[model samples]
Target: MTATRPDPEIPAKLLAWYDKHARALPWRAMPGEPAPDPYRVWLSEIMLQQTTVAAVKPYFAAFTQRWPDVAALANASDEDVMAAWAGLGYYSRARNLVKAARFVAELGGFPETEEGLRALPGVGDYTAAAIAAIAFGRRAVVVDANVERVVARLFAIEEPLPGARKAIRAAADRITPDERSGDFAQAMMDLGSRICTPRAPRCDACPLAADCAARGHDPQRLPVKAPKKVKPVRRGRAFWIEREGCVWLVQRAPEGMLGGMRALPDDGWSAAGDGSGEPPLVGAWQEAGVVRHTFTHFVIGLSVRRYDGAPATVSGKGEWWPIDRLDEAGLPTLFAKAARLARAASERLL
Candidate 1:
């Protein structure tokens, strides 16, 4: 077992690339300026998990604009926070974000060590390492999807993802520079995202082309991945009745898929069957339509039911809505689909 040193040329090669090609992101601290506030970096990283940079910018700006600090975030009402996070998806992340912010504030601020970061809600090893290295200049290896692709191709590893994760981490650590570990980590991510892309790799323009293992093999074929599990289809019934132009909407439970967002009133859903028990809607509920949506783990089939009578708004701390004002309610995409289906059905019947 020998220690691995950074490639003598890699740091220079990658740093040069980073200087010229770094993505212009709002959360990023300027080159010479002190690193961004730990709260900002940590918060943004947590939000950015499994989400794209372009999708996260406006959400990031809104969150920082409202809270601006860990203490403020910790003190915000769950409703306000959830409302701010409505369109971003992954409501649990928003919930944990506030929880972690409060936890950190109680402890003074974000812990400088990786261990401290790991202890926060939703901050896993990769996230902790990223924050420790990028924000504090710690010599920690950060392996995201982008970094994973770069590492796998550089070493020509063929093992599928998740299983190949450990080997990729080791390889990334081997090449990560100790001095500017932060820049090195960013460089790996940049290289994968921009140059060594998933489909077509720009090997001709890659800075590390000389040492790339996949250069000899096929650059596009080196980083092989396991086939994805087919998302299981699940079914449910959503009641989308409207009264006096105000539609009825209910808040989803504070956990699980589509949590903390306003949605059409629905019965419980399961993988093996349609919703169990009686639905919340009343007065000869009619099957308005069916809406299909796919989640990360499963596909959902929703039976859209509609009721046109007096407004019944007692759906667990939710509100009745003027159907036309649906946009102001901040419904997620799934609910958006349901709303559209129900509205169209109501018009066709009348």
Candidate 2:
């Protein structure tokens, strides 16, 4: 199909709006300023995936302070990176970040094109397009969730997502200008986030209010979403073996859920098994309590079982982490929640 030309006024209007109200993000350069460093742009984009700007700020600061550059990040130990990323939830992104950093360091610099960026470990279509436009001054159509909403409302595309993505991209492509594509992209995101919000859009304050097609109708109803599938709940058990103010913690296998992170030994909860797996050692076990955690795919109820046997009986490939320093172990969120429950139950018995 022949692509329709973007409204000539859209780019000018958006760019003018961006010049005055662009967000002050660390990864973004001010309007009319030199583009941000590719490394910072890439790192922030990765952390921002499936996460919010508020949640990514402290983590971004910490990572940049420690790694500083792609080379430094490449040289960082896997355990250290994983530990630093403990509470961030998506463990695989942390793993892929290390891999991508190493790959980039080996190449001497980051790729300057969307295609090249996509070749990296975890960089996908949206990430590649964003980096290309924002860091390299390339004219690529960057359509993230925010851009999707804006484009959908601007064109009044009534198709639901996943299926409607093609039409949305075409519509976004029509609006993307040749010059300052990066600013245009960020502007769309800002407009969607601040003015063209999902629940209650501030159409009166929007620069494109006159051009928006959904303005006459319910804008939120555009970019319609498909029905969501029900998330399944799973059950499992965690062992709390305390000895001399230390707890036994094991490193998870490197190829599964929460892989390569230190965690409390459990009855293989991730594999959809009932909380009936054997304990690490023959001991008098008591039910401490349960910790509920939700994953992207499932909800888990982890039964925290305390070991009442002697500490000498606990033998495995795990380390005895000091109870006082448990936070340093970098356990994943689920395991961290379980540890909190175990600690609380222990305190109650005293």
Candidate 3:
């Protein structure tokens, strides 16, 4: 697949289209406007990974309101940031966001180049390119999922994803104009999200439809994806120890899955297929229910059990959280589901 397909006029056409149709996103700067705050761009890109804009909008708003800037986010407590980031699946991103914030704050400001930005704690190749092209007016090839689809369709790169990304990225680079590179990258995103949608692309309205090789030939199928492998299902258990209107919660060790987030004391199981661990304490425990959660690589069936001892014999390094205020504890989605089931099964807690 040749990098420069059809012509070099793709960026010009795309940028012209963007000036009138750029999305009014909270984190994005409109076309022809000054670049947006680098902090917002970085934060939004991190949140947007494996997450949709619709889903990220409210979280982005809340986080920006709370943290405001890199310095404010850096000054925030780990627990506070983690709590605020609850329900946004990838817990590790929140943890890394903290590390990167502190690093950037200490360094005075965000690095302007893609290579420099990639040094941030959790920033990856795609994120670094996006931040550079969008925040610093850098002429970087930004190939996000949307851009991948657009470029693949434009060049009719029939190769499947993961492998075809290289060719698609190369094609995108040829079309990425030097001037207003930020706007060009964003324009491709808008074109893909709106005109070249995954299903039923509106080719007639696309500015680049004239040069699209996949046009009038089922363009939706251009960016083929490899088949998904069967995910292994693992089983685990969660314990609910309640006493005197308080449920026990413990902080996960600062590594591995869901690390540093406050959650229910479980059987030391983090999506493992191993035998379950012993309960926190020996007591007459009743089976409450199961909480089913699906991760990217696997599925987990977390069995919830309740300790119904008279004194609720609890001995552990955890806090007694009031049942009514459990919502504020910021338990990750899985633990939150388990807590709700435990609460529903017990009448004495609330």
Candidate 4:
């Protein structure tokens, strides 16, 4: 059961295990049931990318409830969509989701082939393959993080990640069953997530125990990963201007980091400062403290400053939202944490 000589029965044993034990998810159709709707499949795949299942479940349910179909999502405004996608991070995916949805709607439906799906705004290689296989029942090889681990161990490939990805994909293609490729892909994902985990794997319950290449050896160590580079830290300042029971909020520019989302106006995180040392409004400023948040590439510390001057002097396009209804402002987690800090400080005054 090596990479060059994988057991052909791998897919069958895994799929049989899946038929009886596949995790019941809101977006999946059972083993023998009809394939789920393409729109649902596409949406779920998009939401699940780089995100955990538990984190995505509530968001998926809310999005589907608000926009039931591709056409419905296509008709949504960017503001509403961006706001809905606030806490999901990877803000670009939400932006791309809108673009792809509208494209599918105008085209009248999702493309049924891997190549066709690739042409969509956000559908990359993995996403296109998954949608084609899972929704259209196309015999496409779908390899995600979970599948990568499973295949790496099944064939006992010791090549480190990124570099080993090519060999892993090749091995996966060899073992992929032409029939029920959709099921086979999902089965691999389930087996990887549930049985062949990254940490302590439950190999005793594994259906492919006898056929596993890394069975006698340390299976968890296969699919070695490259060392993670440390993320650099950046600092910025967020202005918290409270007027009566309301707080001022601004919409970020339509592109770049945290773009098109509501946020407490901030001096951009630059040494030269996009708006350094200057608060949005001229007022006596009191520093409330700092809130730290980490992004994919950098960590940020945003200093929250409370304005203690005249509110009438503030004139801008941004609105003074009632502090009580701040939840509906769709602030990203960074600013949300800042708001909480500001509220806690304000409560001390009373």
RMSD of each: 2.5, 1.8, 2.1, 2.2
Best by lDDT: 2
Candidate 3 per-residue C-alpha lDDT over 34-86 given as tens digits, one digit per residue, 9 for 90 to 100: 99999999999999998989989999999999889999999999899999999
Candidate 1 lDDT over 170-204, as tens digits, reads 88877787877777787788788789998889899
lDDT of 1 at 179: 75
lDDT of 4 by residue, 86-186 (tens): 99887888899999999999999999999999998778989999999999999998999998998899888898989998988998899998899999898
- Which sections of candidate 4 miss by over 4 Å? 1-3, 270-277, 308-310, 313-317
lDDT of each: 0.82, 0.90, 0.88, 0.88
Clashes per candidate (backbone, < 3 Å) = 3, 0, 0, 0
Q: Among all windows of ten consecutive residues in candidate 3, which has the lowest summed lDDT?
A: 307-316
TM-score of each: 0.91, 0.95, 0.94, 0.94
Candidate 3 vs. true structure, TM-score: 0.94
RMSD of 3: 2.1
Runs in model 2 deviating more than 4 A are 1-5, 271-273, 308-310, 313-316
Residue pairs in candidate 4 whose N, alpha carbon or C atoms collide under 3 angstroms: none
